[model samples]
Target: MPLSDIVRALNAPATGKRPDFLYRSGLDHPFVAAEGRVFIHYANIRLESKFLPVVDTRSGRTHGHASTIQAFGLSNSVPMSPDAVFVLPTDAEEFVYLDRLVRTLHALNYLTQPVRGNLLLRVHSRHIISVPANHGLAFEEILRPCGLLPEQITLEINTDAVADKEHFIRAVASYRSRGYGIAISHFGRTELDFPFLSQLRPDIVKLDNLLLASGRPLDRIIDNIHELGGRILIEGIDSANLRRNASSLAIDLVQAHAPILRPSGIRIRRNADGGEQLDAAA
Candidate 1:
């Protein structure tokens, strides 16, 4: 259901019952939840298979699909309207896996979707600097296989624990030159240096949700970036209530625990035993 429909139903006269929503995840629900507010009613309620659903707050639909592979089919990780995902090399030894993961994400057949959304794959600053200069994809190289343009796929780098600033800037600039969209992750908490932001000129600034959720206003800084035409993404939206609050903000995007997309319409989830089963909803 569209947000406008919900608004209409909310204001409409006392009808027999309320309107239900068919989520992009294929799950049918009564209504969208708000924090401590009215439980907007919906007519049909059916128990469909449940997964981490990503809800695009901007549009009432799923924009991207993701799974919490690390959480044993129990992920609350949401991939919202804009795509963003956290990637980190466990150690120097796991760099291969990280690289492979990036390559695999780029090669996904679903990337061929006509209106390809942001397929964000995040990584730490150390990994950004560590990418063997010759091995990492050039700007167009990143777009070639995926068929997603430079702007579609975001190379999110968390600066929270950068070990080396000079190397980090170099790596970021290298990617920038190549046309890969740059995302500076954990904006409010780490670095918080205006000059660094000015120099880096990140394509996206992902703010820390902890502070946003705490209700501590970072409006002064956030507004400054907005003025400069920087896109803001709010993460750490872990619950329904949190999402309501996020909607109130002017952030460009959001990451939540809700199910966003069910990639390629395949619902075979990885079980704890390391086996895949067809989701009942499927």
Candidate 2:
């Protein structure tokens, strides 16, 4: 089936129910394709999906690609940060809607690439809190129609962003049972939650580089995460020395790009084992 057809079906409204936000305004579809790539038209901006490479430290191969969205003004082509883009949503419903919409955008764009391995994506904390139950259900539905498997996506949630521990744990379990990989981001940014970590047993733990700078007990934390069967991923290795030191710490994966604000024009030099090398700018 054509991608557009699948998107239409996904966006189609149920009987007697109002159309979802994506199909509202009588627009045929909120997505547009250009240069054989997909982009979403959202909130007067054009959002495009960009993947950040997650490299395996041992063999120096790309382990996976984390999906991130790059937004640009529809009229002026000015770039906008993800934070700025997300701030457009006003209420809980809108927050959930926009969160799912951006993930859908990433999923569609990922399908166009010849990349392999899991696609890691960050789920808005607000989106998780807004949904009372059935977390990951709605996004899983969208993924299925896009010809993507739940097992191929890792839903990442920042540690500091989550407010309700119980709901967050439940949501992570929901994603896990549905076959999506779970990644706990910014693990050491705030106070460590060992009990919560034990309960979740996330597939990946993305460490905040601040732990290293602050002279915290990173080795013990890494050990605990490993005991819980979580792979450690240290992001924000901007300097060569930092990258070298991070590799020596037995980190499973390392991302050299900035975690919070990723750069544009990420050129993939070579593709190996679902991992791609980033340009110097990335």
Candidate 3:
């Protein structure tokens, strides 16, 4: 069936009284029934311009004016809104660039106001050049003035980047002090020590795709995290089977990007084990 037909069918009233438009599109990204409500992923790019006679690597020559471009496919998500879309960066440098871009976009009136929900930005460990401790403070400075609520915005940090117990705790504490939500992305990727993670008490924890793909027993893990007062988001779920499995585990959230365009509709039901399920309707 065509994409429009699939969306139309999914939105039909028969698919349960509650909202039926929730569907997975490309990977683990969720999308509403309407296209306008979907979020887009963007990468950061840097352009350098210098007025000097310098050798060009590509042209193998010198010139009075030269420009260099550096770009990385750092993943970030931004929801569509009347105002300018606020994007979160994957690293400190990207965050810097994003801060400038957001200001420019806002000043130019290219983005409409009032702004929507706070954008969640990812921070990679490699982005910290020296004082990793200052990263959270820097992020708060960049976002607080943008009219984003502390709880509405989240800073996503990979578990690997926070290898140091003391540093991780401090960083999380600093952000929490600023009223910003701290999230640990890609949780359960490795057997890293999580004693501090539980202690620091981040608001969100994104479960690793590995665990979702493995189809392992996750009830205990989910229950434990919930008990610790952390919201869990499961990623990389691409099939009904995986969705069923995740729902059975009672994962707080499941991201699916595939099968949305398919004929099947989003099914929010319960598995035989009495756990929640998110998959295409049979």
Instruction: Point to the candidate with the largest TM-score.
Output: 2
User: Going through the candidates in order, what is the number of backbone clashes in each?
Assistant: 9, 1, 6
Candidate 2 lDDT, tens digit per residue, 13-48? 653222254444444467776676788888789888
Model 3 lDDT tens row, 1-282: 333333343334454421222222221122122332212123332211111112222333321111111122233211122112224444555544444333222211211223323334455444433345555554444333333355655666776545566776776677788776776777777753467668778766777877656767777777777877887765433445655655455655543322221123354544334355577633
* Model 1 stretches astray by more than 4 angstroms: 1-97, 106-109, 112-115, 132-143, 236-248, 258-282
The numbered model that scores best in lDDT is: 2
How far residue 221's Cα lies from its native spot in candidate 1, in Å, is: 2.3
C-alpha RMSD of each candidate structure in angstroms: 17.3, 4.8, 19.9
Runs in model 2 lying further than 4 Å from the true structure? 2-28, 258-282
- Candidate 1: the clashing residue pairs are 19-42, 52-259, 53-258, 53-259, 53-260, 54-258, 54-259, 54-260, 139-178
Instruction: State residue 81's C-alpha deviation in candidate 2, in Å.
Output: 0.9
lDDT of each: 0.48, 0.76, 0.44
Predicted structure 2: lDDT: 0.76
Q: Sort by TM-score, best first: what order?
A: 2, 1, 3
- Report how far residue 194 has shifted in candidate 2, in Å: 1.1
TM-score of each: 0.55, 0.85, 0.50
lDDT of 3 at 150: 53
